[model samples]
Target: AQTVTQSQPEMSVQEAETVTLSCTYDTSESDYYLFWYKQPPSRQMILVIRQEAYKQQNATENRFSVNFQKAAKSFSLKISDSQLGDAAMYFCAYRNINNAGNMLTFGGGTRLMVKP
Candidate 1:
Protein backbone atom coordinates (compact mmCIF):
# COMPACT_ATOMS: atom_id res chain seq x y z
CA ALA A 1 0.00 0.00 0.00
CA GLN A 2 1.09 3.57 -0.76
CA THR A 3 0.39 6.57 1.39
CA VAL A 4 1.17 10.28 1.10
CA THR A 5 1.81 12.47 4.11
CA GLN A 6 1.86 16.26 4.43
CA SER A 7 2.94 17.19 7.89
CA GLN A 8 2.29 20.89 7.55
CA PRO A 9 -1.34 21.76 8.05
CA GLU A 10 -0.91 25.40 7.07
CA MET A 11 1.78 27.58 5.50
CA SER A 12 2.16 31.29 4.83
CA VAL A 13 4.37 32.98 2.24
CA GLN A 14 5.02 36.62 1.45
CA GLU A 15 4.48 37.79 -2.05
CA ALA A 16 7.63 37.60 -4.19
CA GLU A 17 9.23 35.21 -1.71
CA THR A 18 9.50 31.46 -1.90
CA VAL A 19 7.96 28.63 0.09
CA THR A 20 8.57 24.92 0.35
CA LEU A 21 5.94 22.40 1.45
CA SER A 22 7.04 19.15 3.06
CA CYS A 23 5.74 15.77 1.97
CA THR A 24 6.67 12.16 2.58
CA TYR A 25 5.31 8.84 1.50
CA ASP A 26 5.61 5.13 2.16
CA THR A 27 5.38 2.76 -0.74
CA SER A 28 6.58 -0.73 -1.57
CA GLU A 29 6.47 -0.19 -5.31
CA SER A 30 9.51 1.16 -7.07
CA ASP A 31 7.70 2.44 -10.11
CA TYR A 32 5.39 5.33 -9.40
CA TYR A 33 4.80 9.02 -10.01
CA LEU A 34 4.64 11.82 -7.47
CA PHE A 35 2.54 14.92 -7.98
CA TRP A 36 1.70 18.23 -6.31
CA TYR A 37 -1.77 19.54 -6.87
CA LYS A 38 -3.23 22.88 -5.80
CA GLN A 39 -6.88 23.51 -5.02
CA PRO A 40 -8.10 27.01 -4.48
CA PRO A 41 -11.37 28.10 -2.87
CA SER A 42 -12.98 27.03 -6.13
CA ARG A 43 -12.09 23.45 -5.23
CA GLN A 44 -10.56 22.51 -8.54
CA MET A 45 -7.53 20.27 -8.39
CA ILE A 46 -4.75 21.73 -10.53
CA LEU A 47 -1.53 19.86 -11.31
CA VAL A 48 1.47 21.82 -10.15
CA ILE A 49 4.31 19.42 -10.92
CA ARG A 50 5.15 15.73 -11.19
CA GLN A 51 8.22 13.57 -10.76
CA GLU A 52 8.82 10.01 -11.87
CA ALA A 53 10.45 7.73 -9.36
CA TYR A 54 13.02 6.53 -11.91
CA LYS A 55 14.11 10.05 -12.88
CA GLN A 56 17.18 11.31 -11.14
CA GLN A 57 16.62 14.91 -12.10
CA ASN A 58 13.93 16.78 -10.24
CA ALA A 59 10.86 17.93 -12.09
CA THR A 60 10.21 21.66 -12.59
CA GLU A 61 7.43 23.75 -14.04
CA ASN A 62 7.83 27.53 -14.09
CA ARG A 63 8.18 28.58 -10.46
CA PHE A 64 7.25 25.15 -9.16
CA SER A 65 9.87 22.48 -8.46
CA VAL A 66 10.12 19.25 -6.53
CA ASN A 67 12.79 17.71 -4.37
CA PHE A 68 12.37 14.01 -4.94
CA GLN A 69 14.25 11.72 -2.59
CA LYS A 70 13.46 8.29 -3.95
CA ALA A 71 15.39 6.33 -1.34
CA ALA A 72 13.85 8.30 1.49
CA LYS A 73 10.42 8.21 -0.10
CA SER A 74 10.15 11.97 0.27
CA PHE A 75 8.74 14.42 -2.27
CA SER A 76 8.51 18.10 -1.43
CA LEU A 77 7.20 21.00 -3.45
CA LYS A 78 8.93 24.40 -3.72
CA ILE A 79 7.15 27.42 -5.02
CA SER A 80 9.36 30.32 -6.07
CA ASP A 81 8.36 33.96 -6.45
CA SER A 82 5.13 33.31 -4.69
CA GLN A 83 2.09 35.37 -5.61
CA LEU A 84 -1.27 36.04 -4.03
CA GLY A 85 -2.83 33.67 -6.49
CA ASP A 86 -0.69 30.88 -5.07
CA ALA A 87 -2.81 30.82 -1.93
CA ALA A 88 -4.55 27.49 -1.92
CA MET A 89 -4.64 24.00 -0.47
CA TYR A 90 -1.68 22.02 -1.73
CA PHE A 91 -1.82 18.27 -1.88
CA CYS A 92 0.84 15.66 -2.53
CA ALA A 93 -0.33 12.71 -4.56
CA TYR A 94 1.00 9.39 -5.85
CA ARG A 95 0.03 6.99 -8.59
CA ASN A 96 1.48 3.72 -9.71
CA ILE A 97 2.96 4.01 -13.20
CA ASN A 98 1.90 0.54 -14.24
CA ASN A 99 -1.68 0.88 -13.01
CA ALA A 100 -4.11 1.50 -15.85
CA GLY A 101 -6.75 3.00 -13.56
CA ASN A 102 -4.20 5.60 -12.41
CA MET A 103 -5.81 6.02 -9.02
CA LEU A 104 -4.26 8.84 -6.99
CA THR A 105 -3.43 8.61 -3.31
CA PHE A 106 -3.36 12.09 -1.78
CA GLY A 107 -2.09 13.62 1.39
CA GLY A 108 -4.26 15.51 3.88
CA GLY A 109 -3.23 18.79 2.22
CA THR A 110 -1.50 22.02 3.31
CA ARG A 111 -3.33 25.30 3.07
CA LEU A 112 -1.11 28.08 1.74
CA MET A 113 -1.72 31.68 2.78
CA VAL A 114 0.01 34.36 0.78
CA LYS A 115 0.64 37.73 2.36
CA PRO A 116 1.18 40.96 0.50
Candidate 2:
Protein backbone atom coordinates (compact mmCIF):
# COMPACT_ATOMS: atom_id res chain seq x y z
CA ALA A 1 0.00 0.00 0.00
CA GLN A 2 1.14 3.59 -0.72
CA THR A 3 0.62 6.54 1.57
CA VAL A 4 1.48 10.25 1.55
CA THR A 5 2.16 12.29 4.63
CA GLN A 6 2.10 16.02 5.19
CA SER A 7 3.40 16.80 8.68
CA GLN A 8 2.31 20.41 8.76
CA PRO A 9 -1.43 20.76 8.82
CA GLU A 10 -1.27 24.51 8.28
CA MET A 11 1.29 27.11 7.34
CA SER A 12 1.46 30.86 6.85
CA VAL A 13 3.72 33.09 4.77
CA GLN A 14 4.06 36.80 4.26
CA GLU A 15 3.34 38.18 0.82
CA ALA A 16 6.36 38.13 -1.54
CA GLU A 17 8.20 35.67 0.72
CA THR A 18 8.96 32.03 0.08
CA VAL A 19 7.34 29.05 1.77
CA THR A 20 8.15 25.38 1.71
CA LEU A 21 5.62 22.64 2.45
CA SER A 22 6.84 19.19 3.39
CA CYS A 23 5.51 15.90 2.03
CA THR A 24 6.72 12.33 2.49
CA TYR A 25 5.48 9.05 1.08
CA ASP A 26 5.98 5.32 1.40
CA THR A 27 5.81 3.15 -1.66
CA SER A 28 7.30 -0.10 -2.88
CA GLU A 29 6.78 0.52 -6.57
CA SER A 30 9.73 1.79 -8.63
CA ASP A 31 7.72 3.54 -11.31
CA TYR A 32 5.34 6.19 -10.09
CA TYR A 33 4.44 9.89 -10.33
CA LEU A 34 4.25 12.48 -7.57
CA PHE A 35 2.16 15.61 -7.67
CA TRP A 36 1.14 18.69 -5.75
CA TYR A 37 -2.40 19.95 -6.27
CA LYS A 38 -3.75 23.26 -5.09
CA GLN A 39 -7.45 23.61 -4.16
CA PRO A 40 -8.47 27.18 -3.54
CA PRO A 41 -11.78 28.49 -2.22
CA SER A 42 -13.33 27.60 -5.56
CA ARG A 43 -12.59 23.94 -4.77
CA GLN A 44 -10.89 23.19 -8.06
CA MET A 45 -7.90 20.89 -7.81
CA ILE A 46 -5.13 22.58 -9.79
CA LEU A 47 -1.93 20.76 -10.68
CA VAL A 48 0.89 22.77 -9.22
CA ILE A 49 3.80 20.56 -10.29
CA ARG A 50 4.74 16.96 -10.94
CA GLN A 51 7.86 14.81 -10.61
CA GLU A 52 8.59 11.44 -12.14
CA ALA A 53 10.54 8.95 -10.08
CA TYR A 54 13.14 8.55 -12.83
CA LYS A 55 13.91 12.26 -13.06
CA GLN A 56 16.98 13.49 -11.21
CA GLN A 57 16.25 17.17 -11.65
CA ASN A 58 13.44 18.57 -9.56
CA ALA A 59 10.32 19.72 -11.40
CA THR A 60 9.54 23.42 -11.48
CA GLU A 61 6.70 25.58 -12.78
CA ASN A 62 7.20 29.32 -12.57
CA ARG A 63 7.37 30.22 -8.86
CA PHE A 64 6.37 26.69 -7.87
CA SER A 65 9.01 23.98 -7.52
CA VAL A 66 9.54 20.62 -5.89
CA ASN A 67 12.53 19.22 -4.02
CA PHE A 68 12.20 15.53 -4.76
CA GLN A 69 14.38 13.25 -2.65
CA LYS A 70 13.63 9.82 -4.08
CA ALA A 71 15.95 7.98 -1.73
CA ALA A 72 14.06 9.24 1.28
CA LYS A 73 10.70 9.25 -0.49
CA SER A 74 10.37 12.94 0.30
CA PHE A 75 8.67 15.36 -2.10
CA SER A 76 8.39 18.90 -0.85
CA LEU A 77 6.81 21.91 -2.54
CA LYS A 78 8.38 25.38 -2.60
CA ILE A 79 6.31 28.43 -3.37
CA SER A 80 8.30 31.59 -4.14
CA ASP A 81 7.12 35.19 -4.22
CA SER A 82 3.98 34.15 -2.43
CA GLN A 83 0.88 36.12 -3.27
CA LEU A 84 -2.55 36.34 -1.68
CA GLY A 85 -3.95 34.41 -4.59
CA ASP A 86 -1.67 31.51 -3.68
CA ALA A 87 -3.51 30.84 -0.44
CA ALA A 88 -5.11 27.44 -0.75
CA MET A 89 -5.21 23.86 0.43
CA TYR A 90 -2.31 22.02 -1.13
CA PHE A 91 -2.45 18.24 -1.47
CA CYS A 92 0.33 15.78 -2.16
CA ALA A 93 -0.69 12.92 -4.40
CA TYR A 94 0.81 9.71 -5.73
CA ARG A 95 -0.04 7.46 -8.64
CA ASN A 96 1.59 4.28 -9.84
CA ILE A 97 2.53 4.33 -13.49
CA ASN A 98 1.46 0.77 -14.09
CA ASN A 99 -2.11 1.24 -12.93
CA ALA A 100 -4.59 1.45 -15.76
CA GLY A 101 -7.19 3.21 -13.64
CA ASN A 102 -4.71 5.95 -12.66
CA MET A 103 -5.95 6.35 -9.13
CA LEU A 104 -4.42 9.01 -6.92
CA THR A 105 -3.37 8.45 -3.31
CA PHE A 106 -3.60 11.84 -1.67
CA GLY A 107 -2.13 13.05 1.58
CA GLY A 108 -3.87 15.03 4.26
CA GLY A 109 -3.61 18.51 2.75
CA THR A 110 -1.63 21.48 4.05
CA ARG A 111 -3.48 24.74 4.17
CA LEU A 112 -1.35 27.75 3.16
CA MET A 113 -2.31 31.19 4.38
CA VAL A 114 -0.61 34.14 2.70
CA LYS A 115 -0.64 37.28 4.83
CA PRO A 116 -0.24 40.77 3.55
How well does candidate 2 score on lDDT at residue 23? 99
Tell me the tens digit of each residue's lDDT in model 1 across 13-107: 99999999999999889889999999999999999999999999999999999999999999999999999999999999999988799899999
43 in model 2: Cα distance from truth in Å?
0.5
Stretches > 4 Å off in candidate 2: none
Report the number of the highest-TM-score candidate: 2
The TM-score that candidate 2 achieves is: 0.99
Where model 1 places Cα greater than 4 Å from the true spot, the runs are: none
- The RMSD of every model to the true structure, in order and in angstroms, is 0.7, 0.5
Q: What is the TM-score of each candidate against the true structure?
A: 0.97, 0.99
For 41-115, candidate 2 gives per-residue lDDT tens digits of 999999999999999999999999999999899999999999999999999999999979999999999999999
lDDT of model number 2: 0.97
